[model samples]
Target chain A: MELDGNSSRGKTIASGVIPFVFVIILMLYIFGPGSDLLDLGIPLPEITIEKIDFVDSEIQATVRNTGPISVEVVMADVNDRIQPAAVEPDKSLERFETALVRIPFEWNAGEPYTIGITIDDGTRFEKEIDAAAPALDFSLDLVVFFAIIGTYVGVIPIMIGLLWLPFIKKISRKKYHFFLALTAGLLLFLAIDSIEEAIDVSDENLAGSFNGTLLVVTIVILSFLVLYYAGEKLVKQANSSKITKHVAIALMISIGIGLHNFGEGLAIGASVGLGSIAFSTFLIVGFALHNTTEGIAIAAPMSRGKLMIGKLVAMGLIAGTPAIFGAWLGGFSYSPFSTVIFLSIGAGAIFQVILVLVKWIKEQDTVLSSGAVVSGFATGISIMYLTSILV
Target chain B: MMILVLSVIVGLSVIAILPVMSEAQLKQKTFVTHSGSVIQTTGEIIDPLYTVSSVEFDPEEFLRNFEYGRISVSESGQTIRDYTIIAEDDKIQEISPGVFFNIWSFNGTVPGPTIRATEGDLVRINFINNGSKEHTMHFHGIHPAEMDGVFESVGSGGGQFVYEFEAGPVGVHPYHCHVMPLEEHIVHGLYGVFIVDPKEERPPADEMVMVLNGFDTDFDTENNFYAANTIPFYYQHHPIQINTDELIRIYVVNMVEFDPINNFHLHGNLYKYYPTGTDLIPSFYTDMITLSQTERGIMEFEYKFPGKYLFHAHKVEFSEKGWVGMFLVNDNHEKNNQEIENGT
Candidate 1:
């Protein structure tokens, strides 16, 4: 990578001196007069309140030491009153270590309270709770609330997208392959989106010791192989006609979309649990708009088949109900590991469905690169991108 | 060329900025060495050697000291010792460099004052709980049921109780808070070494107390730092100064909670190990000894030569996490005497 003799010489000198500089620093630190440097008294002891939970007659706050030096919580006060507070384990928190400071105060529900924590250096950190309410727990009311969210974001929107089935069925035979290609495009977008989301979640929340990226990659490959094997076995067993194969493809597409919607449900539910997002009409509308197009992707595959009313309802349920379960899991116990697992599996399933759809499209009499098929693919991706903005 | 000139400039600048950068980084490193075995923390760290200097509590002073209390002859001709222990929870101590822990201590010190007495002496303890929470000192030696420090919980805010008992079961024992959720009280530094010396005193030399302890700084049910006498690496920084070929007796008490067991290993020497100091005769001769929570023993050893020797927890994790120390052995008695004669 050397450009010229001067540049290469410069590079060599730079690399050599870096180690030389490091050794000198090390020697100075160990044997030199270290007291002056140690007594430099650099700024330290940064702390922050990570979370606050109001238990029965108690306000437990998770506080983290974000500074270079360790800090101790010397005292705690609530509403200008010195409260009997016990910092779990001990009051001193090493750098980045979190301590739960529990204060025993008889606080009224719906009342406002301010908590102040004073460290050993006399520096105090104050956090105000707008309203004192019991921390979120599994309850009947919470279940209904999450179900309503699932219905709006997952079930109802998907069912509305399924209304495209009648119009899709009435189309000419020449346009049948175009709709199938569009379905493939939709599944492809979903696969990439879910995998991208999984990677982000893994990076942010998974433990450093665990190879989270590798875990996602492995899970995706395993799920893809498993789906492909299962599909191949079933098709060979049935010795299925074109109609039966098309029906299987449609079912697979529904299941794939269902998994993607489940991950979507998880995000919505976890946001509520973390209190990062509040329940709002606008958010629900945004989610509903984002997911409405999934139904069309699911319906496009079934257009060639003579689907019964019962089967149509069953497909919709298969493409929707998992979201309800996902919301329940996420709202109650939202773990990033589980979120990563589900998203990776959904991405894998979508990828396998896309593979099946592409093979089916190639079997058609028309060229795979025809204008209709190419435009259908482009249009499908464009629709997903446009709707994704709402989310 | 431009590249050569730029490279030289950069190198010179790096060298020029070296001292400032190293000073900033040295404070953040837990310990610095040539091989880069440094724990890079977020910010500046206080010097471990000087950390206790800022605080009133000194681990070296705590070592080898015994609380004999108010000695009195009772009407029954028995020796009576009256000791008043004020339990407080608000005291903050630097357990390590840059790490401060709110220690629930007796008389404002972790491991309290090493309460020592001859066997069969009448030890009367005036217990006062001045903390915000309830606390009761439970001694591990033989005592009456009423004086057990349990059953009758001492309330907070100037609560008082008198524990009168005959010191028996000659051994080194741990005395700690006996409140319900006892681990919570003990882990927060509510424990101390209780020594009931045998009436027939053993051969004395240089005696010191080494209370093996740990602090779970993050409340994560696991210990983040471990130490002897509450301060991690204190003995290592200021190695315990001892004369060569002199008998050294250590009353080692293990008060680490969460972990099942802890151990002590000495470098370059084996000690006469007394199991709990209960028996006069030495039980085993070994370089290492393991003790569970609250289990303590007496160790007697003498350094044959003059040099620095290391003593630490045999459990590698414990030692690596700060339960290590050193003994600075001196063979300079003749030199010191010569200097004294010369008056230099």
Candidate 2:
């Protein structure tokens, strides 16, 4: 460990905080599977429309309500021609419940019909009825819907980013080179993941023209240039202190991650709106676990620099808050185009961070350890790859 | 030079994807038919103009606990039974959560309270209009046009009008605002049931009153919202409990305007329909019953099984729009204890 006297307090505090965090995560992983504690009711109930289906000329909506508020369902139409609807749990809905409210109506198959229902608590719900034309539910119930979506998308990235501060405070000088390679490896995998997602989103455009391929190539190169210039600007902006330079780079990296996370948030939110609950849960767990490595990437730049608790918090918010905002927007009003644009920005920014890492290794007087660097990169890649597979 | 080339390519790609992508998305959102066929639409497409539905009655359970501001008192030395109903306005009550309806109520609610008494009771209705307009309450039972609340016999806003009449035949009928240009007056939430029980004691049973009405929220001739009670979807959420094998007497009155007639259909149960309270014998044993505007009746049915019985208009349009409700028939208490007795 090589911490100067000036920053020993930060190192000491971070050391204490991270171990406590690890112990809690470890305890949950070990005991949670067998515990009944998670079954306890959520005090505040929230509900969202997951999917709307029209089967056999009847309209039905699948709603997910988390927490403990009771809800009732009824359908009202313009002509008042709704067939009687069957509401499950015909009484009060318990918290942490999902219900499929079947609103059957006798209508012309192609005729446009709309069902509006107002709940007793003064909240109103209006849904357009299109047979098999699934639209995301727009109602008062969706406000809490977006909040939950934000939680699923943001928690993982923010938690993982914040986790690195304590452990990376004072890596031994001997192991610093190894950790740098490891950080590069983690970031490289992120850049790849981001670009792959961006490409996947743009796949819809592949049939029309060569635009998709062009978009991929252009963003990857553009992000590298942007980040390269950003690094140079950080150097020029430095106040002759190593700490200042490191902090600037770290902040820039956080900004890059924030952009990428926002794109990820959009994907998760849209998935929920599309009523793919199983897929949404899978993405949440996979992304959160994968995000566990981002901490190393952000911390690597500041390995030998002064780090304040407040500064680390600022980094976390800069990196993580965008995910929340992104998920909320995604769940509420996400379009496919927004997905491609933001993810492109992310892919570009991360590519920039990887270049900064290479520059760091070359800045040294002696040649970097190639063997340690190669193995560290492999280890880092395998860790992230394995996390993705396992999750 | 390479960066410049890349920037130009990115810019061109963005422009290419924006229009094509957005158009596809709009098409995707609008293509809602079950056939899953994409139908192209444009910005110039206008939605079909719709009319406001008739008087929208809130859910039945919404007014279940409410009395039509019952101010009627049986006084000692008064041969004329005095009934006081305030023709009040501007009381914004929540029929559903956060959904407020402006009701021009007699007393404090739409379909002002049901005034019950024996036949031949002198029904002296004191109509006070605390409203901003003229108001009147006309008895559906036999009454002269002067006491009918029509013509010049109207209570001005912030004034009072006293109507004295002898209750005629024993029957279930609706008393409503009979002010000329009748549709607007009655639909303004000024109507109620006046049940005059037969002099010979009728068979005792659990009873409820259902007033079928619709609302023209936009004041257009079309009735957009409809309900059995004043609040829509009330009985669906908070179901009316009925014990199995219990006779349920229902006094249903159709005060709905815009539509000529409305039907009351009960799912999983059938009832004896009486077009008028005058008949001791029911008109028929049917699952569905229909009543015309201002036509009131007394109906009875007994649920034989334990389950949720849906009651709504047979006309699918009227029932689904806002006139839907449920009666949850519970198992008899004594029946549940039989299993304990058997120790099975």
Residue lDDT tens for model 1, B1-344 = 99999999999999999999998775553434223334334433323332233345688899879999999999998899999999999987776543467789999998799999999999999999999999998999899899889888889999999999999899898899999798899999999988998888889689999999988765768776688988766787778999876889999999999999999999999999998899999999999999998898999999978999999998877876668889999996875677789996
C-alpha RMSD values across all candidates: 22.4, 24.3
* CA displacement after TM-score superposition, residue A265 of candidate 2 (Å): 28
Off by over 4 Å in 1: A1-180, A191-199, A202-391, B1-31, B34-56, B332-344
Q: Compute the lDDT of residue B338 as modeled in candidate 2.
A: 78
Please name the candidate that would achieve the greatest lDDT relative to the true structure: 1
lDDT of 2 by residue, A1-391 (tens): 4557649988889999999999999889766787765567644333444345545545655554433456544332233343334344342345545556555443454455555443323333444543333445667566566666565556556656656655666666546667667877877777788778778867742222336657777877786787778778877777565558778777877877877778877777765554444345676677677776776677777766775767776776677667777766767675555677778878888778767776776675425557767777778888888877844
Residue B72: error of model 2 in Å?
Answer: 11
Stretches off by above 4 angstroms in model 2 are A1-391, B1-79, B333-344
lDDT of 2: 0.66
Q: Report, for candidate 2, the interface RMSD.
A: 14.5
Chain B global fold similarity (TM-score) for predicted model 1 against the true chain B = 0.84
